[model samples]
Target: MSKITIALEAAVATVIENSPKDVRQTARQRANVDRAFAGILKLIAPRIRHFIRQYGLVAHWDDAEQCCAIAVHRAIEAYDPAKAQFTTFVNWQLRGELQSLRFRLMTDQRPSAKKVEATTVSLHAITVGTEGEEASLESMIEDENALSLTESAASEQMAGDLRAVLIGRYVDHLRDVGMEQLKRAARTKRPAAQDLAKPRFKAPNHGIDPADIADMEAKLAQHVHLVERRIFDDTCLDDLEQEFGIAKERLRQTAKRAAKTIAELAAAEPRFASELNRKLPQRRRPSKAAVQPAVTIVPDQHAAHNLLTNVVAITPEAGEPLAESIDARLAATLTTLVSETLN
Candidate 1:
């Protein structure tokens, strides 16, 4: 749009083409030709900048500029005045070169679309499972070494006793987790209809009878209360030291046994473990009730610390009598009651 560009274009159309006989020979004709070339450069200069930016050629601008210059020159040389306007012809030519330029600058540009190969793995080729009955990798399988069935029980003697400390800590952990989950559930707003349209997850079967849990809880609670009070009393610890040569470690193991029993009890009856989630009262439309999820304890830092502390406290001194007394039997009997279900 510059005056020089406009003038050069007009000059090329009129003066340069019409005065071809005098071109290169006459100084005036040569001036017109030079003007036309300058005009061409001006026309493609902005386009070259655009291509550089569009093709991410800014890092190699000088090279891109040179390429664009060559493309422009080729366009001018190959131009057919009878077929199209100079501007249209130049645009078409530049477009082709720009397409190729874009490919070259792509870093991984290919001549055509990349062909993707279909991938399939032969699971049947691999055999797995126990010796004789081994099946292919495709068939459902499991490792026997990984076959660990967790049962809640202890040695016959200690099975009668349960540790109150472990049960109390487990209860505390459960309460904490329940509070957190309830708070989160309260804060959560229902999703939109579209979101609800998506498939909802179905919880796996717990296989627990809540009624059994209630019965076990009642029996266990009575024992747990009595045992916990005795455990904290120094008289009880001294009695064990004076009568039974029971190791403090044996006490912790006893607690662990009780903890395992509680776990088994809960597993046996999920309903008693946690009440079904009850929604907060609403004045208007009632809200859908959520299922109350049970809390599971995995031994971690806090649990480990609790165990260590209990061990230090319950452990009797080496100087104390290792001999079992009648008083120690009461302690063992009370602890054993934790596992026994009330008739």
Candidate 2:
């Protein structure tokens, strides 16, 4: 190894080295807020044009300029003194933000950098309510998965329907409680053994026997179409009343009571209420076009049965006895064939 001899001199500041007295650097550090946001517009302009041409992400040039300004502001906070220029440091930062914006736009999350101020929603903000002050948005918007009105209403209506069905099921039982109390004369009389033995109605017990409640649920399930039709579609109270042969006022009262009961159930047992939405019946409406094609009773012979059949009138409505007429001689054969096939 060759030995090298070095002579030391007073060091001078190179361009790469930081100068404590540099006026421009000091000004940049102190007065960083520049009113000329359009300063960076030229830098981001070509990129915006390229993005529009290549990706076809529909965003105005002004929007890109604003985003670049925001990124530049953020980058200024992290400006490295070792970097050759502040502008170069900001260029890369602005580029990254624009690229991120492009990716977000591609995914259909169009962020409005200009319109939406850089702020935060305090998810824990306290808001006063009828009951008391409570947690804010985080508490209120609990079900983010339930996004659509139809979906939200379906769940809500199920709970309501279940509550209504429960109320309607216990109508006679509740009425009897009031009636028996009212008819108990001021003067003492012989207490009926059955009345004395009857269970006292305390309500989260639902004022009814558990067996009666189970029976009600079964009945509601069997006639779920009634609830679906009345609550969900073609909600004609008069039609329902006439169809069921119940008094119109009585029907209205029953409906009103059911509504009130559902509200109570929701307040008391919200978790159980939310689960009830799964039980809501969706009404199936068959269009005339859809129905007419599927219903053609083609009287064809079957090899399995070795029977031939002809068709006669089978009326579905009172308008007319609609039927496809086949050979009159085969009418008996067809009737016999149908009976045998069905059996």
Candidate 3:
């Protein structure tokens, strides 16, 4: 009955009547519709604000405003003059939006809810202490040594992966040593039972003696610990070699293997790879300390001919069956080694 209520109804009617159905509207038609919507929003602005306050959504005022606008747009699209007055229809829509907004704000998993809880705490407030000598909440919470849970978990996972790779290498080394001993026994025509009786490490699930496996595992654990310290703590290879009585070259070789294995592992896991890349120190460029002239050697035709003739003269003898058997055995061993490496 009021002029504002009549004007609001007219704007809603204009929207419903002029809104494009199956095709795009003309620019003029679009402008007319937009003007109608602007009028409707202006008329409902006070109502939206009132409902937001009514629902106690002060902390989320901006979000509540957005929700109210969406609710108004939906109400206009669905409104029917025959059913109820535009004022009544819009009031119900605003109420629904306000209720939903409140629910979202109060949900435990919502970031806004977390923020609200965070704001409730005062950093300077004395939460722990005895009377005069009290510590603030912020002081109690801060820790210099504390690492974020994500970074801590990532570091632990990376260390575990490194340990697994080291143990794998040790196992492979033991197998290689056992294989050589087995080969020697076969060449000497030793009995199979005698070969098994000797304390030699063999591939897992193969009929390796239990005592040998236990010993291998113990040695693997000790080697892994020492290698872990060397790789992670930047411990000197010389110190490890002297302390453990192992050759420094062997320790250096182990570190190289670890680097290669870690690269392959990181290639499979992007998250770990990114973390590793971020933590890796930048390599320094070598300084230009010295310059030397290049030297070239002249090739002699006689020497080149001799080298070619030497290469061409060598050939495998087809008559030697022992050589053929050896070749076949070597090929089979190589195939098995390749398959194991891939796995």
Candidate 4:
């Protein structure tokens, strides 16, 4: 049959023939079975590495490698090729082992006070980037001020109502057709005399006749297309296809059209640059607004008060040694509790 089937059959034959004489085999068959096991392990090692990376288990690669090896051995011993492919059976066993290891590692450690402090410091350092390349606190503040100014200028230029419609229709929910329909409905409801009496305005809306609402509609269509590309990358295509009942090819074509329109609008309009500059404020570096204060609350407040009072009242003679011991123990317990909470 297939190469896999042939290999598996050979492996099984070897295993059966290699069985010990007392247990049910010959030295020759045993050697063949051992050779098969080695061959299978070599073939699967790359697959194990690929799986580890694919699942973001790279940090635990060493343990995952060992687990995969063990899983393969177990699979070989228990495999029933009549019911399932050997590769499929082995994959199931490997997944189960890896998941078990993940659970064990997650649950085994009791978090300690030192661990919490270390994590907090690490997160703070990460926000500032690497040591040499980090922006100075002063520079960060200045950049923030510039961003805010740009945003205010842009906001002043764009009609508040139109900006809200653009953000709500395109940026937030990606309802391009719905946005167009809404605009059309609003135009229909506008007083008929107002619609008819324009100065018949024309260019330096740049080749786009300022008199034409068609040009603005065209620009809005382009903006929505650019946003969809950013939100849905290749990994999301399958889900999008399933949810929308559209073939992958059709969805891709639609996305491309939208992106092209957005690129055109960005290229054609001076206001686009100003708007982009304003939006830069939305991309500002995350601030410490959400940083939480570190605090420990003890349920046994009365006990804690008594202990503190006794330590404070200690006299030099008999109390000093006992108080030192109690202080050390209290410090250790507090450290452990803090660590667990932080973790």
Say which candidate scores most in lDDT.
3
Return the TM-score for candidate 3, rounded to 2 decimals: 0.33
Quantify how close model 1 is to the true structure by its C-alpha RMSD in Å.
40.3
| Top TM-score model | 3
Candidates' TM-scores? Answer: 0.27, 0.22, 0.33, 0.29
Model 1 lDDT per residue over 308-339, tens place: 65332234664255445656987899778975
Q: 1-343, model 3: which lDDT tens digit per residue?
A: 9988999999988888788789888888888889998999899888877888888888889999888888888898888889899988988888998888777566554577687774345688976565667799888788856668768999999888866764565556655675565455445764356465678766464544566656656776676667677877789987898888889898889878766765665555666567666766779999998887555464443665656553233355754876888999999999999999999
Point out the higher-scoring one by TM-score: 2 or 3.
3
Residue 288 in model 2: lDDT: 61
Q: Which stretches of candidate 3 lie over 4 Å from their true place?
A: 108-343
What local lDDT does model 2 show for residue 80? Answer: 57
Query: What are the runs in model 4 whose C-alpha is more than 4 Å off?
Result: 1-5, 20-27, 107-343
Clashing pairs in 2: none
User: Clash totals for all models, in order?
Assistant: 9, 0, 0, 7
When sorted by TM-score, best at the front, the candidate numbers are 3, 4, 1, 2
User: What C-alpha lDDT do the candidate models reach, one value each?
Assistant: 0.57, 0.53, 0.76, 0.63
lDDT of 1: 0.57
